[model samples]
Target: MIEYRIDRRSGVATYVQIVQQTKQALRMGLLEPGDKLPAAREVVEATAVNPNTVLKAYRELEREGLVEARRGLGTFVRRSLGAAPADSPLRGELAEWAARARAAGLERDDVAALFAAVLDEHFDSTAKEQENR
Candidate 1:
């Protein structure tokens, strides 16, 4: 199970943060289908947010078909965000790359920005190639 964290200074709403973090966990394969999310009360206790905020996040996830809430149990992951398998060879390679980046003194945000830029460039080139075809 993934623990939820909230940044009150983030300017994003607390409920939205909860929902986005859950989705991010799903994307990263930390939360898989059938995994139970922390109970709303648990989240409230952990984050000191209103119970309704947690419920709202869960409801939004349900609306997105990512999770389901059982009557007596708790919200469970219904689907993943289609990330590569955890054991994929690319994951190992990426880990090594991240280690190298850290060794090179790149901060996490800098690495993330570099990655996002490269990903965008790759997709843009692919789209242009498709258009040419």
Candidate 2:
């Protein structure tokens, strides 16, 4: 069973909320490859959300190659893309600061500020190093 939640209060669309939560669950190994997802109707019933919303989420997941929906069957998790390092482009050290800021209750604009500050610091340090050389 997939364990996830939809934040109705968030500005994000319902489908996007579901897609992100499902992706997080997959990345965290909470929902492993080959695990079957609830049927669209079942999901709607369980979450008290619209069936169309659930279907849209599933379609997005399918596009991302994270899940596959079978005709007359149901959706299933796809195996992880073979052994790429977890620290891909979005997992760099600089990204850690942004993640931390988000976890600390910062909004998108706040995270942007944190990112800009880090970029400025990096550029200043590089310029100083060049001057010293």
Candidate 3:
């Protein structure tokens, strides 16, 4: 089971946040197939969000084939997003790198921008390399 959190300051829609967090949980292996998500009432109670917002999020997940809502029960995970574990070597190295970046005076946004650029470049290059092969 996963607890829901909302960041009203983020400017993102509440339902979108729920959808993203659910997908993130899938990626992190926190929610596996067959795992029941918190009831909409539970989410509403926890986050003070509208029931419709949670239902919208769950519906989006269902459309994406990531989850299914049973008539009598609750929404359940249907698929995984396939992410490495948090304790993986790559994650540890990235955390260390992030710490170093912070120590070197890089702000959170700067670090995120740098990482996104590098990730785009790496994937682009890898795709080109595959094409060449």
Candidate 4:
């Protein structure tokens, strides 16, 4: 069974919560490749969320190459996401931030501030992160 939950009051959008939960499940190895996910209707019933919310989440997952949908069947987990290649821009940026944060003795709060600062300084980062596929 899928171990997922949604919080109505969370700052995150409903669809975003679903995407993150699925990603977390994949990273934790709780949901393996070829595992069939609950139907969109089932997820909506379980979470008491709108069907469109669940559909948007599933669509986002499929777009991310994390899941595949079969007509009249359902969505299933795809192969595990591969490690970032050395030349990937995101990998480089993450590595740089890790080093900077460590050097600056930053904690979670600091990282949060840094993220907010980035968003504040350049609004495009938020859209870019969202658009990243």
Clashing pairs in 1: none
Q: Where is model 4 more than 4 Å wrong at Cα?
A: 82-128, 131-133
lDDT of 4 at 1: 50
lDDT of 1 by residue, 9-114 (tens): 9877888888878987887788999999999888889888999999998998999899999999999999999666677778899999999999999999999999
lDDT of 3 by residue, 1-133 (tens): 9998999998778888898899888878889899999999999998898999999999989998999999999898988886666566788899999999999999999999999899997776543452353
After TM-score superposition, the amount by which residue 49's alpha carbon in candidate 1 deviates from its true location, in angstroms, is 0.3
What C-alpha lDDT do the candidate models reach, one value each? 0.87, 0.76, 0.87, 0.81
- Top candidate by TM-score: 1
lDDT of 4 by residue, 1-133 (tens): 5756998788778888888888877765667799988998888777788999888999989998999999999999996554454456776898898789979999878888888887688765644587474
Residue 68 lDDT in candidate 2? 97
Q: RMSD per prediction, one decimal?
A: 6.3, 11.1, 6.3, 6.1
Which parts of model 2 are misplaced by more than 4 Å? 81-133
Q: lDDT of model 2 at residue 98?
A: 67
Per-model TM-score versus the true fold: 0.80, 0.59, 0.79, 0.62
- Cα deviation of 60, candidate 1, in Å: 0.6
Which sequence of candidate numbers ranks them by TM-score, best first? 1, 3, 4, 2
Clashes of each: 0, 0, 0, 0
